[model samples]
Target: MDSLTADDFFALDLPRHAQLIDGTLIVPEPQGNFHSVSPYVLAQGLRRTAPGRLRVRRQMCVVIGARDVPEPDLVVVNASADGGPCLMSYAARDVLLAVEVVSPDSEERAQDTKPRKYAAAGIRHYWLVTMDENNRPAVHTYELDPHTGSYAPTGIHHDRLKLAVPFTIDIDLTEIDRL
Candidate 1:
């Protein structure tokens, strides 16, 4: 971790996906087709609301703390005015929101640990997207709690995932399944 930087992480050519947290590498659990569906739907839906000002990036490495550079499933950031290439890395402050889609293999970290890290990094919003017992697209939105420096659950949605934070938008849960 002390020896690695955001640039180093990007330069590596790994055989599979990995994330760098606290100087260690983490490989995500194998996922099925359903795990990929929600991210695509949410990214597309958010893009419709963001229009020309915000950029929605999927699976980009984000530098949170000194050694925490995890690739969030999706991230929403302010678009660059120069209109050049997309950024290679984003500091925590530049991120408006980070979205993580949970799979069976990621239950522990996604639910129990990642939110704390995101909150500690001062990310204003975090959404934990998962499949519920009924297999519906479940989105749980968290906002940073300034006093405690932790995340507070602001909203949970199943059918119509709507929120005013980050931006006002309505995401159809069924669309996630259809996609």
Candidate 2:
């Protein structure tokens, strides 16, 4: 295995999805605009409604453990800790939620890679947003069951989804279609 750590991965200027798993570097394909925007909308919504309960960030590197650091599309962390640096370096317990906007070229990465990684890292909540051909967003929310190391589907939102913390708000899916 490669001797790369999360610190080593962070030091690089590479563009694709570069993560460190078990001290090995993994570079997945790059993301597209459609993949990027959906998460942006969600992040903005979280910031506006639940400023105290949730922290919305984009492309923030989270260190799930010593050997793994993956930068998710949007990370919903504890609101009190918003200005902190490198999420990947934080303990898995600090991550309140993790969201991934699916890239057309990296469907498998979203469907398989992220779920396994996040579940292993002990993230409590995870979301996967899929964009239709017209670029509309469909949201799937998962809550991790630590006992099984599996995520149970909590809800699916097509047009709008209700967010639970910081404040109550609805994220309109129609905006995703515009992206």
Candidate 3:
């Protein structure tokens, strides 16, 4: 198919899981239980104490430009704008954080390509969560550099993910359940 405009993509009545990346529509591979629930766990954790302005959403479609609308595993955006939206999509500029949980189905996209798009779109923070052999979520975080238009590695989080951006929180990875 030819490259599609945002309107053309949305008007296709594509499934919710469909995403437009660089003008191509791709459907993410099927998710497992862990992939599905991790978002809920993260959302639950973030919303527990998030400030009113920030809302945590899973599989939130983001408009990265006219031809891309990739949905990150989780997104943190300003709730106060657009009457406190908790809906279909948000502009990339409104995104404060974007998280992608790595699964075998789409490892490279999560660890590589998606982060590039997120940073290029000027999203402030991006995280890639991958599971180890023993079933631990190892988080690699990134921060966008305005000067270079790229992302700089902040840290790789293991047992705990302590953050001061997109709100402050110290998450105990072991405490989060995934089945």
Q: Give the winner by lDDT.
A: 3
Tens digits of lDDT, candidate 2, 1-179: 46877667778786655767667776766667777677778877777775566667777777877677877788877766655673334446677788888776557767787778899888888888897555678888888887899888888788787867324768877876665
Better of 2 and 3 by TM-score: 3
Q: Which of 1 and 2 is ahead in lDDT? A: 1
Candidate with better lDDT, 2 vs 3: 3
Number of clashing residue pairs in every model? 1, 5, 0
List the lowest-lDDT window of 10 residues for candidate 1: 80-89
Quote each prediction's TM-score.
0.88, 0.82, 0.91
Model 3: per-residue Cα lDDT over 1-179, one tens digit each: 89987778878878768888889998887898767766666677778767888888888789998988998999888885434444578899889999999888678888888888888899999888888565777888889999898899989887677888757867777665533
lDDT per residue for candidate 1 within 1-179, as digits (tens), equals 35665566777885455887666778887778767788888898898887577789888777897767887889987786223565567778778889998887777778877777888889888999988777777899988889999988998898887877778888788885565
Off by over 4 Å in 3: 82-86
What's the C-alpha lDDT at position 8 in model 2? 76
Model 2: per-residue Cα lDDT at residue 176:
65
Model 3 Cα shift for residue 149 (angstroms): 1.2
Q: CA lDDT, every prediction?
A: 0.80, 0.74, 0.81
For TM-score, the strongest prediction is 3
